[model samples]
Target: MEAKQFQLAEELRKSIRGIVKTDEPMAKHTTFGIGGPADLYIEPADTDDLAQIIVWLNERQIPWFVLGDGANVLVADKGIRGAVIHMGKPFRKVKIDGEKVIVGSAAKLDKVVSATVDAGLAGLESTAGIPGTIGGAIVMNAGTYRGQIGDVTEKVCVVTTDGVQLEMTPENLQFRYRWSVFQEDKNKIIVEAYLGLKPGNKEELVRTMEYIRHRRNMNLPTVGRSAGCMFKNPDGYSAGQLIDEAGLKGTSIGDAVVADKHANFILNIGKASATEVKELAERVRGTIKGKFDIDLEYEVRIIGDW
Candidate 1:
């Protein structure tokens, strides 16, 4: 069955101008640099090309997953079974129109922050130094000390599994702690976003972003392969502090370890497997739960078959 799927994927690859691969390693694309191969990986040339591919795949009843910069995802050891569409250069276009910024889903969060600040816009300054694209940020409601992506997002364009486009508003998005309506809906894929930001002094914005960068560098493990914060901060409590208090810091399972710099972050100590990371995360969660009676929920997206 796997061989037959690969053959079909090859045939489909020839139909599109975008790059496509069969049995593409998930590790190569993810921030953690781990996981097994994906059955089919496709990079659409542009929005139109993506739409066409989505339609074709929908018609054939083929399953597909949309990939951003892979900053906060954990692909399984057995790997993904169907198509994985990775939006590249074509989807990374960023445009600033007055106080409103129009950005593609594949546009990096850092790029958006820089562009907005350069344009004298203020809302996105706090998002500086965050990895991954705008789409992933919006879906996860990515935020820090300043504010969340939800605060700036005025509108979002998503492509549904049925090949239908949806223009969703903030109220309709159901944004919450480390989640959004997009995260709840498996079939929806964020394609672009319209951000409404307030005007601000350019120098002040630059200084703010610089301060954020300094704080992030001091607190997080930026050198290693990591998927940012491993667990969401439970209400009124930081996940890192809890893990540290439980004495789980610097804990290791194979090559995956709880980062010494930040106990909430699980770093891939080179050649780490997704299974190892998951196991370590579970152990941390168990320890924290046992010690504090507080369950630590995963902030990173864990996908694919076990």
Candidate 2:
């Protein structure tokens, strides 16, 4: 490491009270099981640590990314620059107060769903089958055909270099199909969340969850090492349907393959490189456009050296 990089890592560790990993392998962090490494990987112990680290990174003008459960993200083989704040066990906390639930940024979406069901709370049932953290869910307005996180999200807690920004809702943060203000501003990081839900029968909610799970099992490629959903649905057409119609399902480049079950999902069949996956994704997009004449927009965030 260079003197400047070493100093930055030292300063980051000093500023935050948490685990700080120097030159950490990002392949282990992401769900795709790809990526090279991050110069500095941090996991803040609490909200205070999270706040302090953001401030420090900004002061040094060092680039940093807030990584949640690493779903819906594609990091390059050359890796990311500066630091990566990994939201993990240290920050994963969920507090339930009647119909209101306060969830930490690192809290898993599945766990939150199960908790709400156990508590006999409705509204969060729509998030059943979605992967990744609550912070990620809120940032991307994660949802299914039945409902979205925006429907129940009362307030979103965020942190930036300036300090902690509090209580943001769909009313303030434009929620659209798989998008929110968090994507527009990389500097603003989602930390905690407050969701207001309605009361419902536990048995009914469980049934709803089961039905959603069944749909997901039959449709999405959940068995392999892959990032969920490569492209966003274009208006009336589904991206998966377009790819399947193009007959590119089960197409392969190196070890990466377009899942036969879901064309929108690029699975790492075994030991696939980032370059191969990216190339296959680009090719899939090109083929779909050539056949349909409609451009497809990517939903997953592609970061780091390309």
Candidate 3:
């Protein structure tokens, strides 16, 4: 399998007219700063290049994962055996048309919020401080108390399950709490999206964004190697509150620890491994379940051979 993966990487490097790296360190890409390496790392030049590469890879049955800004994932220490397509800076593009913002899927959600707010757009102010790329945000229906990204989505352009490119309407995408059609079919790759926003007073929008930013700074891990939240809010309960009540805050496993400031976050204080992070999260889950009989589902996506 290793030999075949190497051969596939060679072929991919030769055929795809894009950036390619073998044994690329996943730690460098992920926010957690903990991972081994990806067998093959690719950055397609554009949508045309991306479509062709996906079609080719699918035909060969070579496993692959599409990564956005690498904020919401924990890559395993053993690394990934197949390919990883990184959709980042090179692909991000945003433009405003009247009250609509047409953005590339790789554009950062927070950046989009700021840009739209600068243009006096109102709908995205609620999403001001969310991290990760727009593509990942759409896949997870990322949101806060204000609103979800799926709410303002006018259209989504993606490479479908069968490797066909299509522009789909928002209604076609059944979005629920922290879930979307993309999650149901892992093969779907978001390329771009159109958002419908409303005109607003620039000062008011700025104030709202600032408040959101400050709230995030106060609650989230502002400076640390961590993937924001470890678990999802189960129905009517907040996972952080549950964990704090369970008395698991400041719990540690190896170098990973449940943040004392925000119980939902697991921080890598210094040189933590993916195994430590997962273990600490599981311990928190077990403690919560033991006390409240509620299962804690992970919000952080775990990838690679575990």
Ranking by TM-score: 3, 1, 2
Root-mean-square deviation (CA) per prediction: 1.3, 1.3, 1.3
> For model 3, how does the per-residue alpha-carbon lDDT over 1-306 read when each residue is reduced to its tens digit?
668767888888788788878889999998899888898899988887788888888888878999997888999999898889988665699999999899999999999999999999899888888889999999889998689998999899998646689988877778778888887778778999999999999999999999999988887876568988889899999999999999988899989999989999999998999999998898898898899999999999999989
Clashes of each: 0, 0, 0
Look at candidate 1 and tell me the lDDT of residue 7.
79
lDDT of model 3, residue 111 = 93
Candidate 1 deviation (Cα RMSD): 1.3
TM-score of each: 0.96, 0.96, 0.97
Q: Candidate 3 clashing pairs?
A: none
| Alpha-carbon shift of residue 268 in model 1 (angstroms) | 0.7
For all candidates in order, the CA lDDT equals 0.88, 0.86, 0.89
**What ranges in model 1 sit over 4 Å off?**
none
